[model samples]
Target: MKGRLFLIPVTLGSPDYRYVIPEKVLEIIISLRKFIVEDIRSARRFLRMIDPRFPIDESEFMILNKHTDYKDLDGMMSFLKEGSDTGLMSEAGIPGVADPGSDLVLQAHENGFRVIPLIGPSSIYLALMSSGLNGQNFAFNGYLPIKRADRIREIKNLQTMARRGQSQIFMETPYRNMKLLEDIAATLDNNIYLCIAANITHPDEYITTRTVSDWLKKGFPDIDKKPAIFIIGIKS
Candidate 1:
Protein backbone atom coordinates (compact mmCIF):
# COMPACT_ATOMS: atom_id res chain seq x y z
CA MET A 1 0.00 0.00 0.00
CA LYS A 2 1.19 3.52 -0.78
CA GLY A 3 1.84 5.85 2.17
CA ARG A 4 0.41 9.37 2.35
CA LEU A 5 1.90 12.57 3.75
CA PHE A 6 0.54 16.09 4.41
CA LEU A 7 2.69 19.20 4.66
CA ILE A 8 0.87 21.65 6.93
CA PRO A 9 1.91 25.25 7.51
CA VAL A 10 1.41 26.76 10.95
CA THR A 11 1.65 30.40 11.90
CA LEU A 12 3.35 31.10 15.19
CA GLY A 13 0.78 31.54 17.92
CA SER A 14 0.32 35.00 19.39
CA PRO A 15 -2.34 36.75 21.43
CA ASP A 16 -2.71 39.37 18.71
CA TYR A 17 -3.14 36.77 16.01
CA ARG A 18 -5.37 33.72 16.06
CA TYR A 19 -4.51 31.42 13.17
CA VAL A 20 -7.45 29.58 11.75
CA ILE A 21 -6.76 25.99 10.87
CA PRO A 22 -9.58 24.86 8.56
CA GLU A 23 -11.99 22.28 9.89
CA LYS A 24 -10.87 19.88 7.15
CA VAL A 25 -7.24 20.42 8.07
CA LEU A 26 -8.03 20.03 11.74
CA GLU A 27 -9.77 16.80 10.87
CA ILE A 28 -6.59 15.58 9.22
CA ILE A 29 -4.61 16.54 12.29
CA ILE A 30 -7.00 14.67 14.54
CA SER A 31 -7.24 11.58 12.39
CA LEU A 32 -3.57 11.08 11.65
CA ARG A 33 -2.11 8.08 13.43
CA LYS A 34 1.40 9.54 13.34
CA PHE A 35 2.92 13.01 12.91
CA ILE A 36 6.51 13.99 12.09
CA VAL A 37 7.08 17.40 13.64
CA GLU A 38 10.00 19.81 13.66
CA ASP A 39 9.59 20.28 17.40
CA ILE A 40 7.48 17.76 19.25
CA ARG A 41 6.83 19.98 22.22
CA SER A 42 5.82 22.95 20.12
CA ALA A 43 3.55 20.79 17.98
CA ARG A 44 1.76 19.51 21.06
CA ARG A 45 1.37 23.02 22.34
CA PHE A 46 -0.12 24.15 19.05
CA LEU A 47 -2.53 21.21 19.06
CA ARG A 48 -3.70 22.06 22.53
CA MET A 49 -4.29 25.66 21.51
CA ILE A 50 -6.26 24.61 18.45
CA ASP A 51 -8.58 22.19 20.21
CA PRO A 52 -8.45 21.14 23.82
CA ARG A 53 -10.90 18.34 23.05
CA PHE A 54 -8.50 16.79 20.53
CA PRO A 55 -6.57 14.12 22.33
CA ILE A 56 -2.98 13.64 21.10
CA ASP A 57 -1.35 10.72 22.84
CA GLU A 58 2.44 10.96 23.12
CA SER A 59 2.88 7.70 21.24
CA GLU A 60 1.03 9.09 18.20
CA PHE A 61 3.50 11.88 17.46
CA MET A 62 7.11 11.50 16.30
CA ILE A 63 9.68 14.22 16.82
CA LEU A 64 11.90 14.83 13.83
CA ASN A 65 14.31 17.62 14.49
CA LYS A 66 16.06 18.06 11.14
CA HIS A 67 19.17 19.35 12.89
CA THR A 68 19.45 16.19 14.93
CA ASP A 69 20.45 12.65 13.98
CA TYR A 70 16.81 11.55 14.25
CA LYS A 71 16.24 12.99 10.77
CA ASP A 72 17.53 9.80 9.16
CA LEU A 73 16.19 9.61 5.61
CA ASP A 74 16.51 5.85 5.79
CA GLY A 75 14.37 5.76 8.88
CA MET A 76 11.73 7.85 7.16
CA MET A 77 11.85 5.50 4.23
CA SER A 78 11.25 2.56 6.56
CA PHE A 79 8.35 4.39 8.21
CA LEU A 80 6.74 5.00 4.83
CA LYS A 81 7.18 1.36 3.93
CA GLU A 82 4.67 0.53 6.62
CA GLY A 83 2.04 2.58 4.73
CA SER A 84 1.50 4.94 7.65
CA ASP A 85 0.24 8.40 6.84
CA THR A 86 2.56 11.12 8.18
CA GLY A 87 1.99 14.81 8.73
CA LEU A 88 4.78 17.46 8.66
CA MET A 89 4.44 20.81 10.42
CA SER A 90 6.83 23.58 11.38
CA GLU A 91 6.61 25.99 14.31
CA ALA A 92 5.80 28.94 12.09
CA GLY A 93 5.27 29.78 8.46
CA ILE A 94 5.13 27.00 5.90
CA PRO A 95 7.00 23.79 6.38
CA GLY A 96 9.83 23.11 3.87
CA VAL A 97 10.41 26.82 3.23
CA ALA A 98 13.03 27.84 5.81
CA ASP A 99 11.98 25.03 8.12
CA PRO A 100 13.81 21.69 8.36
CA GLY A 101 10.86 19.63 7.15
CA SER A 102 12.00 19.72 3.53
CA ASP A 103 14.35 16.81 4.03
CA LEU A 104 11.49 14.51 4.93
CA VAL A 105 9.51 15.73 1.92
CA LEU A 106 12.46 15.01 -0.37
CA GLN A 107 13.06 11.57 1.09
CA ALA A 108 9.39 10.71 0.95
CA HIS A 109 9.25 11.75 -2.68
CA GLU A 110 12.30 9.64 -3.53
CA ASN A 111 10.58 6.61 -2.07
CA GLY A 112 7.43 7.35 -4.16
CA PHE A 113 5.14 8.31 -1.29
CA ARG A 114 2.39 10.78 -2.19
CA VAL A 115 3.10 14.25 -0.84
CA ILE A 116 0.67 17.17 -0.45
CA PRO A 117 1.29 20.80 0.60
CA LEU A 118 -1.64 22.61 2.23
CA ILE A 119 -2.11 26.34 1.75
CA GLY A 120 -1.65 28.56 4.78
CA PRO A 121 -0.31 31.92 5.92
CA SER A 122 3.25 32.87 4.97
CA SER A 123 4.72 35.94 6.69
CA ILE A 124 7.44 36.35 4.05
CA TYR A 125 5.08 36.64 1.10
CA LEU A 126 2.72 38.78 3.15
CA ALA A 127 5.57 41.17 3.91
CA LEU A 128 6.50 41.38 0.25
CA MET A 129 2.94 42.17 -0.76
CA SER A 130 2.63 45.10 1.67
CA SER A 131 6.19 46.31 1.29
CA GLY A 132 6.32 49.16 -1.24
CA LEU A 133 9.27 47.49 -2.96
CA ASN A 134 9.95 45.92 -6.32
CA GLY A 135 7.89 42.79 -5.86
CA GLN A 136 8.39 41.94 -9.54
CA ASN A 137 12.00 41.22 -8.70
CA PHE A 138 12.51 40.18 -5.12
CA ALA A 139 14.70 37.72 -3.27
CA PHE A 140 14.37 36.20 0.19
CA ASN A 141 17.96 35.96 1.45
CA GLY A 142 16.93 34.14 4.62
CA TYR A 143 19.00 34.90 7.77
CA LEU A 144 21.95 37.27 7.59
CA PRO A 145 25.33 36.47 9.11
CA ILE A 146 25.83 36.78 12.86
CA LYS A 147 29.33 38.25 12.59
CA ARG A 148 29.39 41.98 11.97
CA ALA A 149 31.94 41.82 9.18
CA ASP A 150 30.22 39.00 7.32
CA ARG A 151 26.79 40.57 7.76
CA ILE A 152 28.11 43.91 6.55
CA ARG A 153 29.51 42.32 3.41
CA GLU A 154 26.28 40.46 2.75
CA ILE A 155 24.19 43.59 3.29
CA LYS A 156 26.46 45.58 0.96
CA ASN A 157 25.95 42.99 -1.78
CA LEU A 158 22.21 42.99 -1.20
CA GLN A 159 22.19 46.77 -1.25
CA THR A 160 23.88 46.74 -4.62
CA MET A 161 21.12 44.47 -5.93
CA ALA A 162 18.50 46.71 -4.36
CA ARG A 163 19.94 49.68 -6.20
CA ARG A 164 19.30 47.77 -9.41
CA GLY A 165 15.64 47.48 -8.30
CA GLN A 166 15.53 44.04 -6.66
CA SER A 167 13.71 43.91 -3.34
CA GLN A 168 15.75 42.05 -0.73
CA ILE A 169 13.82 40.36 2.09
CA PHE A 170 15.43 38.86 5.18
CA MET A 171 14.57 37.96 8.75
CA GLU A 172 16.13 37.53 12.19
CA THR A 173 14.97 36.34 15.58
CA PRO A 174 12.73 38.87 17.36
CA TYR A 175 15.41 39.89 19.87
CA ARG A 176 17.91 40.51 17.06
CA ASN A 177 15.61 42.93 15.20
CA MET A 178 17.13 45.99 16.83
CA LYS A 179 20.67 44.90 15.97
CA LEU A 180 19.68 44.11 12.40
CA LEU A 181 18.01 47.50 12.05
CA GLU A 182 21.09 49.18 13.45
CA ASP A 183 23.29 47.41 10.90
CA ILE A 184 21.03 48.59 8.07
CA ALA A 185 21.06 52.18 9.29
CA ALA A 186 24.85 52.19 9.56
CA THR A 187 25.73 50.51 6.26
CA LEU A 188 23.15 51.45 3.64
CA ASP A 189 22.87 54.79 1.92
CA ASN A 190 20.72 57.30 3.79
CA ASN A 191 18.35 57.75 0.83
CA ILE A 192 17.76 54.04 0.26
CA TYR A 193 14.23 52.84 1.09
CA LEU A 194 13.75 50.06 3.65
CA CYS A 195 10.54 48.42 4.80
CA ILE A 196 10.04 46.65 8.09
CA ALA A 197 6.97 44.40 8.36
CA ALA A 198 6.65 43.33 11.96
CA ASN A 199 4.10 41.05 13.58
CA ILE A 200 2.30 40.43 10.31
CA THR A 201 -1.24 39.05 10.55
CA HIS A 202 -1.31 40.05 14.20
CA PRO A 203 -3.35 42.83 15.77
CA ASP A 204 -0.24 44.87 16.54
CA GLU A 205 1.09 44.35 13.03
CA TYR A 206 3.24 47.12 11.61
CA ILE A 207 4.45 47.72 8.07
CA THR A 208 6.49 50.82 7.48
CA THR A 209 8.90 52.02 4.81
CA ARG A 210 11.30 54.88 5.13
CA THR A 211 14.68 56.14 4.06
CA VAL A 212 17.64 54.95 6.07
CA SER A 213 18.37 58.47 7.30
CA ASP A 214 14.72 59.09 8.20
CA TRP A 215 14.50 55.76 10.02
CA LEU A 216 17.55 56.68 12.07
CA LYS A 217 16.10 60.10 12.87
CA LYS A 218 12.79 58.53 13.99
CA GLY A 219 14.50 55.70 15.88
CA PHE A 220 13.00 52.77 13.92
CA PRO A 221 9.61 51.17 14.56
CA ASP A 222 9.11 50.25 18.24
CA ILE A 223 8.27 46.63 17.56
CA ASP A 224 8.02 44.96 20.95
CA LYS A 225 10.03 41.80 20.35
CA LYS A 226 7.65 40.38 17.76
CA PRO A 227 8.57 38.20 14.79
CA ALA A 228 9.24 40.44 11.79
CA ILE A 229 10.20 40.42 8.12
CA PHE A 230 12.50 43.20 6.86
CA ILE A 231 12.74 44.19 3.22
CA ILE A 232 15.17 46.63 1.63
CA GLY A 233 14.78 48.17 -1.78
CA ILE A 234 15.81 51.04 -4.01
CA LYS A 235 12.64 52.78 -5.12
CA SER A 236 12.06 52.42 -8.83
Candidate 2:
Protein backbone atom coordinates (compact mmCIF):
# COMPACT_ATOMS: atom_id res chain seq x y z
CA MET A 1 0.00 0.00 0.00
CA LYS A 2 1.20 3.49 -0.91
CA GLY A 3 1.82 5.96 1.89
CA ARG A 4 -0.04 9.26 2.23
CA LEU A 5 1.08 12.71 1.06
CA PHE A 6 0.76 15.34 3.81
CA LEU A 7 0.44 18.93 2.59
CA ILE A 8 2.33 20.83 5.27
CA PRO A 9 2.30 24.52 6.19
CA VAL A 10 5.16 26.61 7.56
CA THR A 11 5.32 29.97 9.32
CA LEU A 12 5.52 33.15 7.25
CA GLY A 13 8.63 34.70 8.86
CA SER A 14 8.27 34.30 12.60
CA PRO A 15 10.66 31.70 13.99
CA ASP A 16 8.27 30.90 16.83
CA TYR A 17 6.03 28.31 15.23
CA ARG A 18 3.77 28.35 18.31
CA TYR A 19 2.21 31.58 17.06
CA VAL A 20 1.06 30.54 13.58
CA ILE A 21 1.63 26.75 13.35
CA PRO A 22 -0.65 24.36 15.25
CA GLU A 23 0.68 21.63 17.54
CA LYS A 24 -0.66 18.81 15.35
CA VAL A 25 0.99 20.27 12.23
CA LEU A 26 4.31 20.57 14.05
CA GLU A 27 4.16 16.95 15.18
CA ILE A 28 3.34 15.79 11.63
CA ILE A 29 6.27 17.77 10.25
CA ILE A 30 8.57 16.30 12.88
CA SER A 31 7.48 12.77 12.11
CA LEU A 32 8.11 12.97 8.38
CA ARG A 33 11.79 12.24 7.69
CA LYS A 34 11.38 12.42 3.90
CA PHE A 35 10.09 15.57 2.24
CA ILE A 36 9.45 17.14 -1.17
CA VAL A 37 10.32 20.78 -0.53
CA GLU A 38 10.65 24.07 -2.34
CA ASP A 39 13.90 25.00 -0.57
CA ILE A 40 15.86 22.32 1.24
CA ARG A 41 17.78 24.75 3.43
CA SER A 42 14.68 26.61 4.56
CA ALA A 43 12.81 23.36 5.15
CA ARG A 44 15.63 22.06 7.31
CA ARG A 45 15.82 25.33 9.19
CA PHE A 46 12.06 25.23 9.86
CA LEU A 47 12.29 21.68 11.14
CA ARG A 48 15.06 22.59 13.53
CA MET A 49 13.23 25.72 14.63
CA ILE A 50 10.20 23.69 15.68
CA ASP A 51 12.31 21.07 17.43
CA PRO A 52 15.93 21.90 18.24
CA ARG A 53 17.05 18.27 18.18
CA PHE A 54 15.42 17.38 14.83
CA PRO A 55 17.69 14.97 12.91
CA ILE A 56 18.89 16.88 9.87
CA ASP A 57 21.29 14.20 8.67
CA GLU A 58 18.91 11.24 8.51
CA SER A 59 16.22 13.13 6.57
CA GLU A 60 15.85 12.87 2.78
CA PHE A 61 14.64 15.81 0.71
CA MET A 62 13.63 16.12 -2.95
CA ILE A 63 13.76 19.56 -4.52
CA LEU A 64 10.66 20.90 -6.29
CA ASN A 65 10.80 24.34 -7.83
CA LYS A 66 11.00 26.30 -11.09
CA HIS A 67 14.40 24.80 -11.85
CA THR A 68 13.29 21.26 -11.02
CA ASP A 69 12.82 19.16 -14.14
CA TYR A 70 9.36 17.63 -14.74
CA LYS A 71 10.90 14.18 -15.10
CA ASP A 72 12.18 14.42 -11.54
CA LEU A 73 8.60 14.44 -10.18
CA ASP A 74 8.13 10.73 -10.89
CA GLY A 75 11.31 10.02 -8.96
CA MET A 76 10.05 12.13 -6.05
CA MET A 77 6.81 10.15 -6.02
CA SER A 78 8.74 6.94 -5.46
CA PHE A 79 8.87 7.51 -1.69
CA LEU A 80 5.10 7.15 -1.48
CA LYS A 81 4.95 4.05 -3.63
CA GLU A 82 7.60 2.49 -1.45
CA GLY A 83 5.46 3.16 1.70
CA SER A 84 7.36 6.19 3.01
CA ASP A 85 4.93 8.91 4.07
CA THR A 86 6.08 12.25 2.62
CA GLY A 87 5.45 15.88 3.45
CA LEU A 88 5.17 18.70 0.90
CA MET A 89 6.14 22.13 2.20
CA SER A 90 6.76 25.65 0.90
CA GLU A 91 9.27 28.29 2.00
CA ALA A 92 6.38 30.03 3.76
CA GLY A 93 2.66 29.41 4.32
CA ILE A 94 0.98 26.18 3.20
CA PRO A 95 1.65 24.08 0.13
CA GLY A 96 -0.19 24.97 -3.13
CA VAL A 97 -1.91 28.43 -3.45
CA ALA A 98 0.78 30.15 -5.53
CA ASP A 99 3.26 27.42 -4.54
CA PRO A 100 5.30 25.01 -6.68
CA GLY A 101 4.08 22.09 -4.57
CA SER A 102 0.80 22.21 -6.49
CA ASP A 103 2.41 20.07 -9.18
CA LEU A 104 3.42 17.44 -6.67
CA VAL A 105 -0.07 17.35 -5.15
CA LEU A 106 -1.55 16.87 -8.62
CA GLN A 107 0.82 14.01 -9.32
CA ALA A 108 -0.09 12.39 -6.03
CA HIS A 109 -3.81 12.51 -6.85
CA GLU A 110 -3.29 11.01 -10.30
CA ASN A 111 -1.24 8.17 -8.85
CA GLY A 112 -4.01 7.36 -6.31
CA PHE A 113 -2.01 8.51 -3.29
CA ARG A 114 -3.90 9.81 -0.25
CA VAL A 115 -3.11 13.52 0.12
CA ILE A 116 -3.85 15.16 3.49
CA PRO A 117 -3.73 18.98 3.78
CA LEU A 118 -2.86 20.40 7.18
CA ILE A 119 -4.19 23.76 8.33
CA GLY A 120 -1.93 26.81 8.82
CA PRO A 121 -1.30 30.47 7.97
CA SER A 122 -1.87 31.56 4.36
CA SER A 123 -0.75 35.12 3.54
CA ILE A 124 -3.50 35.47 0.93
CA TYR A 125 -6.47 34.53 3.13
CA LEU A 126 -4.97 36.20 6.19
CA ALA A 127 -4.87 39.53 4.36
CA LEU A 128 -8.35 39.16 2.89
CA MET A 129 -10.02 38.29 6.17
CA SER A 130 -8.44 41.35 7.80
CA SER A 131 -9.20 43.70 4.93
CA GLY A 132 -12.83 44.93 5.21
CA LEU A 133 -13.17 44.22 1.49
CA ASN A 134 -15.75 42.04 -0.25
CA GLY A 135 -14.95 38.66 1.32
CA GLN A 136 -17.85 36.70 -0.23
CA ASN A 137 -16.52 37.54 -3.70
CA PHE A 138 -12.81 38.07 -4.23
CA ALA A 139 -9.94 36.91 -6.43
CA PHE A 140 -6.26 36.28 -5.85
CA ASN A 141 -4.34 37.52 -8.93
CA GLY A 142 -0.97 36.28 -7.67
CA TYR A 143 1.72 38.75 -8.83
CA LEU A 144 1.18 41.73 -11.09
CA PRO A 145 3.30 42.39 -14.18
CA ILE A 146 6.72 43.95 -13.57
CA LYS A 147 6.50 46.60 -16.27
CA ARG A 148 4.91 49.80 -14.98
CA ALA A 149 2.58 50.30 -17.94
CA ASP A 150 1.40 46.69 -18.03
CA ARG A 151 0.89 46.57 -14.29
CA ILE A 152 -1.19 49.74 -14.39
CA ARG A 153 -3.31 48.22 -17.15
CA GLU A 154 -3.92 45.09 -15.08
CA ILE A 155 -4.80 47.23 -12.08
CA LYS A 156 -7.45 48.99 -14.12
CA ASN A 157 -8.85 45.65 -15.26
CA LEU A 158 -8.97 44.44 -11.67
CA GLN A 159 -10.81 47.60 -10.70
CA THR A 160 -13.46 46.80 -13.28
CA MET A 161 -14.10 43.51 -11.51
CA ALA A 162 -13.88 45.24 -8.13
CA ARG A 163 -16.59 47.64 -9.22
CA ARG A 164 -18.92 44.67 -9.57
CA GLY A 165 -18.43 43.86 -5.84
CA GLN A 166 -15.50 41.46 -6.31
CA SER A 167 -12.25 42.31 -4.53
CA GLN A 168 -8.90 42.12 -6.32
CA ILE A 169 -5.82 40.82 -4.45
CA PHE A 170 -2.30 40.83 -5.88
CA MET A 171 1.34 41.00 -4.82
CA GLU A 172 4.70 42.41 -6.00
CA THR A 173 8.36 41.56 -5.46
CA PRO A 174 9.61 42.85 -2.10
CA TYR A 175 12.10 45.34 -3.58
CA ARG A 176 9.47 46.84 -5.91
CA ASN A 177 6.58 47.10 -3.40
CA MET A 178 6.80 50.89 -3.11
CA LYS A 179 6.73 51.29 -6.88
CA LEU A 180 3.59 49.18 -7.11
CA LEU A 181 1.90 51.27 -4.41
CA GLU A 182 2.73 54.38 -6.44
CA ASP A 183 1.07 53.00 -9.55
CA ILE A 184 -1.99 51.96 -7.54
CA ALA A 185 -2.39 55.44 -6.04
CA ALA A 186 -1.83 57.15 -9.37
CA THR A 187 -4.12 55.02 -11.54
CA LEU A 188 -7.00 54.22 -9.16
CA ASP A 189 -9.87 56.52 -8.33
CA ASN A 190 -9.77 58.31 -4.98
CA ASN A 191 -12.73 56.37 -3.60
CA ILE A 192 -11.23 52.99 -4.37
CA TYR A 193 -10.03 51.36 -1.13
CA LEU A 194 -6.62 49.68 -1.02
CA CYS A 195 -5.53 47.16 1.60
CA ILE A 196 -1.83 46.79 2.24
CA ALA A 197 -0.86 43.84 4.45
CA ALA A 198 2.89 43.58 4.94
CA ASN A 199 5.19 41.27 6.91
CA ILE A 200 2.22 39.10 7.84
CA THR A 201 2.62 36.75 10.84
CA HIS A 202 5.79 38.69 11.82
CA PRO A 203 6.07 40.88 14.88
CA ASP A 204 6.30 44.00 12.69
CA GLU A 205 3.22 43.08 10.65
CA TYR A 206 1.15 45.97 9.30
CA ILE A 207 -2.29 45.70 7.73
CA THR A 208 -4.44 48.65 6.67
CA THR A 209 -7.27 49.46 4.26
CA ARG A 210 -7.82 53.00 3.07
CA THR A 211 -9.08 55.02 0.14
CA VAL A 212 -6.61 55.85 -2.62
CA SER A 213 -6.91 59.54 -1.80
CA ASP A 214 -6.45 58.97 1.91
CA TRP A 215 -3.40 56.78 1.28
CA LEU A 216 -1.88 59.47 -0.96
CA LYS A 217 -2.35 62.11 1.74
CA LYS A 218 -0.88 59.94 4.52
CA GLY A 219 2.06 58.69 2.41
CA PHE A 220 2.74 55.00 1.88
CA PRO A 221 4.40 52.93 4.59
CA ASP A 222 8.10 52.06 4.41
CA ILE A 223 7.47 48.67 2.93
CA ASP A 224 9.90 48.77 0.02
CA LYS A 225 11.67 45.53 0.84
CA LYS A 226 8.90 43.70 2.70
CA PRO A 227 6.68 40.91 1.40
CA ALA A 228 3.11 42.23 1.12
CA ILE A 229 -0.41 41.79 -0.23
CA PHE A 230 -2.27 44.54 -2.14
CA ILE A 231 -6.06 44.40 -2.22
CA ILE A 232 -8.26 46.78 -4.24
CA GLY A 233 -11.99 47.22 -3.80
CA ILE A 234 -14.77 49.77 -3.27
CA LYS A 235 -16.50 50.01 0.11
CA SER A 236 -19.78 50.93 -1.55
Candidate 2 weakest lDDT stretch, 10 residues: 13-22
Instruction: List, residue by residue over 1-236, the lDDT tens digit for candidate 2.
Output: 78899999999987678999889888988999889999999999888989999999999998998788777889999899999999999988989889888888999999999999999999999999999999999999999998889999999999999999999999988999988988888899998999999999898999999999999999899998999999999885
Candidate 1, backbone clash total: 0
Candidate 2 positional error at 228, Å: 0.3
| TM-score for each predicted model, relative to the true structure | 0.90, 0.97
lDDT tens readout by residue for model 1, 25-54 = 766766665777878788877777666766
| Residue 184 Cα positional deviation in candidate 2, in Å, after optimal superposition | 0.6
- For candidate 1, the lDDT comes to 0.80
Report the error of model 1 at residue 38, Å: 1.6
